[model samples]
Target: MALFKTSNPALGTKTFQDAAARYGGAIDVANRMTLNGTVNRTGILLICAFATAAYTWRAFMQTHDPADVSGLLMLGVFGGFITAMVTIFKQSWAPITAPIYALLEGLFLGGISALLELRYPGIAIQAVGLTFGTLLTMLVLYSSGLIKVTNKLRIGIIAATGGIALFYLMEIILGFFHINFVSINGSGVIGIAFSLFVCAIAALNLVLDFDFIEQGVNAGAPKFMEWYGAFGIMVTLVWLYLEILRLLSKMRSRN
Candidate 1:
C-alpha cells in the first residue's frame, strides 16, 4: 500500500493522517514524560528534597562542632562515589538506583550547605533562593526563544564540565599531598570571580537539560526516557545548587 492515505467522504485523499497522528502522539508522550510519569521521578525527587532539608538542618545544628565539620568534609567522597555508580550503571540503576543516588547527593549537599552556613551565616537561604531563581530564569529564556541549544553548545558544555571535574580532582590530589592552595572554594578577588564563572556554567547546564527533553520528545523516544529526563534535571539542579552555595560562601567570607 501507499505510505499514507486519507479517508474523505467524497474523493480519497493521499494524506497519512493516522500515521501522522500516531507519530504526533508518540512525540507528545515523550515530551510529557515527566508530567505523565510523575509518580516515579517525582517520588524520588520529593524524597531527595526532604533528605536534603533534614540533612541541612542536622548540619546546621552542629555547625559549631569541629567533629561535625570534619565528618561533613567526607561528603565529597561519598557523593562522588554515588554519582559515579549511577552514571556508570545507568541501566542497572534506572529504577531503585536513581533514588539512592539522589539521597546520597542530598546528604552531600546538606553537609556542604551546613559547613558553608557555619562559616557564613544566612548563606544557605541565599543559595537556595538563587538556585530556584536561576532555574526560573533559564526556563523563561528557553520558552521565549532567547536561548537556542545547538550541538556546538552541547559540546562546549560537556568540555567545560569535564574541565571543572578535572579541576576538583586536582584539588583533591593536592589536598592529599598537603599542598593546599588558595582554597578549594577559592579565595579573594580571583576566587570569587572563578566561583561566578563556575556558577554561570552550571546555570547553562539547565538550558541544555531543557533542550534535551524537548529534543527527546520530538524524536519520539520511549516512555522510560522520562525517568532519564528527570535524572538529568536532578543532576543539573544539584550542580546549580552547589555552585550557588559556593558563590554565597565566597561572598560571605568577603564580607
Candidate 2:
C-alpha cells in the first residue's frame, strides 16, 4: 500500500499502512471498510457534536453570562484535547472515543460561540453557513474531479499545515509571557488577510481528507477504520468552522 502525507493527521498514509499490516495479509471481508459506512458514521458523530453544542447553547442563552459557563467551557476544551490525543494514538478506539471528542468540542464551540454571538450578533450562524457551504462546494469539486488530489498537492498542503501548526504553537508558548501575535490576530488588513489564508488552507484540507478516506476504503482497511475516517473528517470540519468563525469575528470587529 502506498502512503501519502495529509494535513489531517487522522487520515495519513501511515494510518492505512499500519492498519493493513496489523490486519495481516488477507483482508477480512466482513470487516472491510466501505464508503457508505464511513458516511453514515460521520453523520452520527456530527449529530453527537451538535447535540452537546445545543445543550451548551441553551444553558448560555438562559444565563447570558460568560462566567456561568466558564467551567463547562474549560471542560470541553481540555477534555476534547485529551480525547483527541487518545483517539489519534489508539485509532482502534475511535468508535468509542470519537463521539466523546465530538460531544466535548460541542461544549466548547457552543460556549465560545454564545459569548462571541453576544458581542457580534449573527456571526455564529454565518460561520456555520459558510463552513457547510464550503464543505459542499469542495465535495462537489472533488467528486467531479475538478480538484485533483495529486501527490504534489498533498505534499504542499501537508507542509503548509505543519508551518501553520508551528506558528500557532509558538503563539501559545509566547502567550504565557504576555506576548501576542497582533499581526495575525488583530482586525487590521494584515490580520484579515492572514485569517483568509488560514481559512482557505483549512478548507483545502477537507479535500485531502476526502481523498484519504477514499484511499482507506480502497485499501480494504478494517471495518473500524470507517469510524476512524469519520473522526478525521470531523476534525477537519471543526477546524474549518472555527477558522471561519474567527475570520468573521475579525471582520466584524473592524466594523
Candidate 1, superposed: residue stretches over 4 Å from native = 1-47, 59-80, 183-185
Candidate 2 has its poorest 10 consecutive residues by lDDT at 1-10
Which RMSD does model 1 reach against the true structure? 11.1
Candidate 2 residue pairs in backbone clash: none
> Per model, how many backbone clashes are there?
0, 0
Model 2, span 1-255: residue lDDT tens: 012356887788678667867873566677888899999999998899899888888899898978888888999999998998888889889999999999999999889888889999999899889989999999999999999999898888888888888899999999999999888899999999999999999989999988888888777888888899999999899999999999999999998
Model 2, stretches more than 4 Å misplaced?
1-5, 24-27
Error of 2 at 161 (Å): 0.7
Question: Can you list the residue pairs that collide in candidate 1?
Answer: none
How do the residues 105-191 of candidate 1 rate in per-residue lDDT, one tens digit apiece?
A: 666677667767767878888888898899889989987999887667766766676678778788899889887657546668878
Error of 1 at 98 (Å): 1.7
TM-scores for candidates 1 onward, in order: 0.75, 0.95
